[model samples]
Every structure is written in C-alpha cells, then in structure tokens.
Target chain A: MSAERLLWYTAVMAGVTYLIRVLPLVLFRREIKSPFVKSFLYYIPYAVLGAMTIPAVFSATRSLVSACVGLAVAVIMAWHRKGLLPVAIAACAAVFVTEWLMRML
Target chain B: MNAAERRQAFKTGFFDGLPIGLGYISVSFTFGMMAVEKGMPAWAAILISFTNLTSAGQFAGLDVIAASGSMIEMALVQLVINLRYALMSLSWSQRLGPEFNLIKRMIIAYADTDEVFAVSSARAVGGKRLRFIYMVGLMIMPVIGWTGGTVIGALASAILPDAVRSALGLAIYGMFIAIIVPPARDHRSVAVVVLSAVAASCLFHFAPVLKRLSTGFVIIICGIGASALGAWLFPVPEPDCKPPDLEERSAHEC
Candidate 1:
C-alpha cells in the first residue's frame, strides 16, 4: 500500500473508533436512572468476557489439543480464585508443555 | 487530591496495567508482522498500531487495506468491529469520578481498549469510582507496549521464535477467563449471564446460518442479549444510586 493510502485508511479507522468511544463519554454527563439499563451495564463486562473467551480460546494455541489443555488449566486455576497473572501464566505454561509432549509423540 | 495521593493512584493504575501491557506486546507483535507480510511498509504498520490501538479492528482494517478496499468499507468494518467500545464507554462514563471532565474524557477515551475497559469496569463494579489521573496512568504502559511491539515486530518478524509466538495467543483469553470466573462463582446471576452469553456465542460460531455473521456482530449480539436477560431476571436494586456523585446517597433509601 502507498504511504498516502495507508495514512488515509488509518485516519478513517482511528476516527470511527474514537467516535464510538468518545461519543458516549461526552454525551452522557449524568447518571442513567433506568433500572434495567443499569443492570444491563453492570452485567455487560462479564457477558463480553464470556463471549470473547469461548470458542476463540479453543483456537488460541497451535493445536486444538494444546488449546483445550490450556483452557482446562486456566478454568481450574481461575475457579480456585487465583490472581490474573498466575492464571494467565499457568495457561501459557500448560499449552507449552502440551505442545512439547505432542511433538515428542 | 494532594500530590502524594495522586502519585499513589497513578502507581496503582500503572501496576494494574502492567500485565495487560505485556499481553498487548504479544498480540500487537503478530499484527505488525502480518501487516508487513501483506506488503505494507514497516513504518506504515507501526503507524497503524500507534494510532488505532485496537486489536481485531486493526487486523480487519489491515485486510481491507491489503485488498485495496474502499474508504467506506474501511470505516464500516472498523465501526462494526469496534462498536462494543461504545457500550463500554457508556458504562465507564457512569463510573467516572468528579475529577473527570470533558477534556479528560476525550483524552482517556483514546485508551479504552478491551482489556483496559475490562480492568477499569471491574474496578468500577467493585464500587470504586474511576479517577482521571489514574486512568492516564493505566493507559501509558499498554500504549508503549503496543507501539513498541509493533515497531519491533514489523522490523524483525523473522527473528521471533515460533514456539513463543504460538504460546502467546492464549494469553489474552486466559486473562479474560481470570476476570470473569471469580465473579461468576460469586453471583449466580452473573454466572447465568456469562454462561448464556458463552452459549450464544458458540451457537453463532458453529451453528448453521448464524455462523456466517462477522465476529463483531456475534459479540455484540451475545453480550447485549445475555445482559438483557440478566437485567430482566435480576434488576440491580437502587439503580439510581450514584456512587461518585452523592456520598450520603450510599446510606440514602433505595
């Protein structure tokens, strides 16, 4: 891509993204009063995280087997109430070990 | 707030963002490599990462640029892929402390990536109001990590090891799991909301017809649907309670 073209596209992408992010923060200066809206907003982060993780997590590693192993380790450790760092590190470690073992086999 | 309190808040946010910044390096490294592989200049790839600061949206936009797609196509793709940020920004605005004004909101909105929003919203949900300087502190590391990784990857994609690259894919998802699981375990309503959203996402991913939808739409649908379900089933008590605005309101009648 030409430098000019790339800059144009990047500007458009950034503009659209910034608008999406900025509009809400700029517009909604007051607290929203609706119970349902508040409840929906409250639950949104969990809902988003859930939707982002599933099926996508299964494809995160080089192989599905390793990915599943990683997911299992992550879920178990997270379920045990481990901190974010340990859980993330454990999942990566599980995927690494699983891939190494598979390579040997 | 005094200088000491300001420093403490910044330190806390900096630490909170440290791991997230590390994760961004891995992801953005791939983005930079791919953009270069597609015949983009290394500087161009770095520029995209520096300005956009989004993961999936940038990836999709890279495809559009590589294919020489139209400007409208680029904007539409970004709009769809990033619509979730609008929802997050709405929630985040409600959680902002009195320190947040229009200027700070504009500046802070630039760093409202998925992981940042996740961390900030988690803090807000814990009943703490988000402050302006703390958010500025939280944004610094991830921005540096993202841009730095892109520069390195675009210039040295061939030098990185395959093993490290492959293992890095799961880091962000693992982080996501860590964020959601503890809360789900605590509240049955949250658990139901999360599980339902996951189920819906799976349907969109694998089921006939629905599987054709783009990832952006899939996420937006599942998130809003499941959240609406939770709202209908379990409305939050005292939704009018503004934690940041009124201190006495904490003890006020619901």
Candidate 2:
C-alpha cells in the first residue's frame, strides 16, 4: 500500500479497536445483574483464547510435526502451571529441536 | 484514595504487568517480522503496533491491506476480532472504583487486552478502588514492549535466522495457552467453553464455505457461541447478598 493508504489503514484499525474496547466501559455504567450475563462474561476469556490458539498453533512453525510437538510441550507446561516465560521458552525450544531433527531427516 | 495509596497501587500494578510486557515482546516481534514480510515498512508496522496494540487485529488488518481489500472490509474485520474486548470492558466496568472518572475510563480502556484484563480483574485490591491507578501501571509496559518489539522485528527480520524466527512465532500461541490452560484446569465450565470453542474453530477451518470466512468472524462465532453455551450450561449461583454499590463493585466477584 502507498504511504497515505497505509496511514489510513492504521488509523481506521486503531479507531475501530479503540471504539470496541472503550464503548462498553463508557456505556455500561450500571452493574450487570443477570446471572446468565455474568456466566457468559466469565467464559469469554477462555473461549476466545482457546479459539485463537488451536489450528493456528499448527501453522506457527514451518513443519506441522514440529508445531505439534511444540504445542504439546506448551500444553503440558501450562497444565503444570508454569509461568508464561518458562512455557513460551520451552515450547520454542521444543520446536527448534524438532525442526532441526526434521531437517536432518 | 490518597495520592500516596494511588502511587503505591501504580507501582504494584507495574510489577504485576512486567512479565506480561516481556511476553508481548516475543509475540509482537513475530508480528513485526510478518508485517515486514507482507511489504509493510518497518516504521509503518511499528506505528500500527503503537496505535493498535492488538496482535490478531493488526495481523488480520495487514492481510486485508495486502489483498487490497476495501476499507469497510478492514473495519468489519477489526470489529469482529476485537469485539471480545467490549465484553471484557463491560466486565471491568464494575471493577473500576467510583473514583474512576470518564477520562480515566476512556484512557485505561485503550489498554484492556486479554492479559491485562485477567491480571487486573483477578487481583484482590483489599476492597479498595485503586483499580484505575493499577490499570495505568499495568498498561505502561505493554505499550512499550509491544511497540518496541515491532521496531526490532521489522529492523532485524533480515538478520534473524529463519529457524529462530519460526520458533519464536510459536511464542504468541504459547502465551495464549498459558493464559487459558490454568483457568480451564480449575473451572469445569471454562474447560467446556474452551473445548466448544476449539470444536467450532476446527469446523470453521475445515468446512468449505466456513473456511472462507474471515478470521475475525470465525472468532466471533466461536467465542460468542461457546460462551453462550457455557452460560446455558453453567450459570453462577445467585449472590446471597445484595449487589455491592459502585465503589464496592470492585470487590472480588470475578
């Protein structure tokens, strides 16, 4: 894209994202009383993060097998409640080792 | 409350946010490399990170820009992908102390990412209303780490070895897993929601027409659909006490 077009795209993206984030905080001045709404809100984080994760993880690396191995490592580490950095580094390292082995094969 | 208390809350929030900020660097570094590979200039990619601070939205926006998609398409895509933040913000609306004015609400809402929301809402602030101060502290490092990582990634993409970059790309997914798995393990309802979302996302990925749907729409469908299912299946028991006042709403319900 041209410089001007890129600028516009960035602005629009920023504006839309900001509006999505801020509008609810500004508008929902009253406490939400509904149990169903509360339950839905509670689930949003897990569902959104999980949906974003899978399948996408398989594509993050060059090789599918390596990515699978990396994801397994990540899931295992996270299941054990490892901190984010440790889990991230472990997963990355697993992919690195797996990718190297695959290359040799 | 007082100026001193506010300053302390900000400090504590800054510390709480440090690890998340570090995690963001690795993720945004991957984003920067991808953006440059897609023909965005380093400055443009950095600018996008600086303003947007959203990994999925910026990545999707770049795809739309590369495809020469229409402005409306870009807006719609962002709207769909970032819509979850609206839910998060609504949840947080009750968390902010009465001291949070309109200006502070707008400013802090700008930094309300998944990790920030999780961290800010989960912490027990001793029944106090210093959340706005804490949020300010939480947002500070992420803004820097995200934008800074982009600049480094765009500048260093050519120099970084492919093997290392590819491995680093998984860091963002790792972060997501780190965020979700612990919560899922604790809450059966959360696990069900996650499994449902994964199923929905997989169906969208494989089905012919659904596969053609934009990433944003797919996320919206899966997130809302799964959460709605979770709500139907597992409603929170009604609170025994009356709802707290606005100031006390920041108490530890979430």
Candidate 3:
C-alpha cells in the first residue's frame, strides 16, 4: 500500500474508532433508554467477546492442548486468584516453554 | 466529581493496569516482530501499537498488507473489526465523567479495551468520575507495554525463535481458555464462548460461502452474528452490571 493510503487508512480507523467510542457519550448521557436496545446491548459485549475469543482457541488443529494449557495456568492463578501480573507471567511462560519443548522434540 | 477525585481515578487506573501491561508486552512484542517480518518498519510497528492498541485488528491489518488489499479494503476491515469499540465507548460514555469535554472524551476514547472495559464497567453505574478512574487504571500499563513491546520486537525480530513466535500465535487461544474454561466447569460463559468459536471455525473451514471472506470480513461476520445471537438469547442489560453483591458473586458467579 502507498504511504498516503496507509496513513489515510490509519487515520480513518482512528477516526472511526474514536467516533464510535465518543459518539455514544455525545448522544447517550444518562443511560440508554430503549428496553430492546438495552436488551440487545446486553448481549453485544458477550457476543463480541465470545466471537473474538472463541476462534482463537479452537480452530484448525482441534487440539485443545494449547488452549487447555493456557487455561489451566490462568485458572490456577485467577482461582488462587493471584495478581493478573503474576498470572500472566506464569501463564505466558508456561505456554511458551511448553511450545518450545514441543518444537524441540 | 472533584479535582481530588479525578486525581484518585488517575492514580488507581494507572496502577490497576500494571499487570495487564506485562501480558500486552509479550503478545504485542510478538506482533511487532511479525510486522517487521512482514516488512513494516520498526517505527511503523511501534506506531501501530501506540495507535491501534488492538491485537486482532493489527494481526488482520498485517494480513491485509500481505494480500495487497486495496485502500478501501483496509479501511473497511478496520471499520468492521473496530466497530465494537464504538459500542463500548457509547456504553462507557453514559458512565464516564459528565464534565468530560469533547476533547478529553475523544482523546481517551480509543483507550477502551477488554481490561479497561472491565474496570470502567465496575465503576460506571456509580459515576463518570469513577469510570474515568477505572479507565485510567486499565490503560496506563497497556500503553507502556504495547508501545515498548513493538519497539523491542521490531528490533529483535531476527533473533526471536520460531517456537516463541508460534507460541504467540496461540495467545488468543490461550486467552479463550482463561475466559471460557472455568466458566464451563459451572454452567457459565462456556456455552456462548464455545458455540461462537466452533460456529465461526466451522464456517471458516467448511462453509463454502465463508471461504471467500477476508480475515476482517470473517471476524466481523462471526462477531456480529454470534454476539447478536448471544445478545438476543442472553440479553445482558445495557449495563450488564453486577448488583454489587460481591460476596454472593464471588462464591457462585465468578
């Protein structure tokens, strides 16, 4: 892509995303009014989060090993409910190290 | 509410996000490395980190670059993928500081993320000032980690191992586990998460119609579809908030 084009796309993305983030504040100050809208909004995040997180975990290989390893580590951490920092470190380290060994063998 | 309160939110928001910063670094570091591998300059990669603060968008954008997508394609992908931020921001707008000026609101808007959303949502029902604080806690560390990771990855792309790179590819998958699995043990987010993922993947792999879709298109379609369904079925409130019964929630809900 051309430099101008890339910059334009970046700017547009930033602009659109910003607008999306900001426009609501501009329009809905007190609270969203409509019940259906409210009901729909309720599921939107869950749906989005579900959509975003799911494909990442279980596509292509069907091996839950990688996902499971990361989950087990995270659950242990979040359950004992240690700090997210420690949990992240432990989890990322475990996954990376495990992948490393797997690759080696 | 007051200057003192705003200051408090700032401090808490900044500190609260510290741990998330570490995770952002590892994953985003890999992103920067991949950008370099794909021929993006280090500055470009770092700039992307500073600006986008999104994992999926960046990864998809890189693919767009690889495919030599048109300008329209690039813009549309970003628009599609980042559309949720608009809703997130809108939801947040209701809760964040009422006194917030347009500029402040605009500047801080893109700072919303999953973690930021979590923290900000916690305080949203109470007041704008508190929401702002929660947002602050959520972002301070991520910005540092993300920007710093880009620079490091861009610099060390050549040195990073394939094993590590592959591991990073699984970061999203790992996160799903963290989000979905525990909930499954009970009867929780497991169904929605599992269904959405399986549905999308199956579509991507088997559904002939879905095969023609770009990465951005795939994400948008799957996200919008699954979220729409979950929304209809589950109907989480606009706020979707917990009623501050922390003790009860902690014991049973998660």
Top candidate (TM-score): 1
For B125-177, candidate 3 gives per-residue lDDT tens digits of 32223344546556787789878878888897656565554444444334433
Q: Which stretches of candidate 2 lie over 4 Å from their true place?
A: A1-5, A100-105, B1-23, B30-40, B63-73, B118-130, B240-254
Which DockQ value does candidate 1 get? 0.71
Top candidate (DockQ): 1
Better of 1 and 2 by TM-score: 1
Please write out the lDDT profile of model 1 over residues A8-43, one tens digit for every residue.
Answer: 998999999999999999998998888999999988
By DockQ rank, best first, the candidates go: 1, 2, 3
The TM-scores, one per candidate, come to 0.92, 0.81, 0.73
lDDT of 1 at B210: 96
What is the per-candidate TM-score for chain B?
0.90, 0.77, 0.68
State the lDDT of candidate 2 residue by residue for B1-254, as single tens digits.
68987787888778667666766776788889899998889999999999999888998998998998888999998998888788788877866788778899899888988777766644532334336777888799889989988988899956667888678767767767776787677767778999999999999999888898777777778889999999899885556211123124335322
lDDT values for all models: 0.84, 0.79, 0.59
Candidate 1 CA-lDDT value = 0.84
Q: A10-103 in candidate 2: lDDT tens per residue?
A: 9999999999999988888887778888777766767877887877789888889988999999999989877666887888899999999988
Q: List the residue pairs that clash in candidate 1.
A: none
How would you encode candidate 1's per-residue C-alpha lDDT over B86-117 as one tens digit per residue? 99999998899998888999999999888898
Q: Which regions in candidate 3 have their CA more than 4 angstroms from the true location?
A: A1-9, A58-64, A76-83, A100-105, B1-12, B63-70, B122-130, B158-208, B211-254
lDDT of 2: 0.79
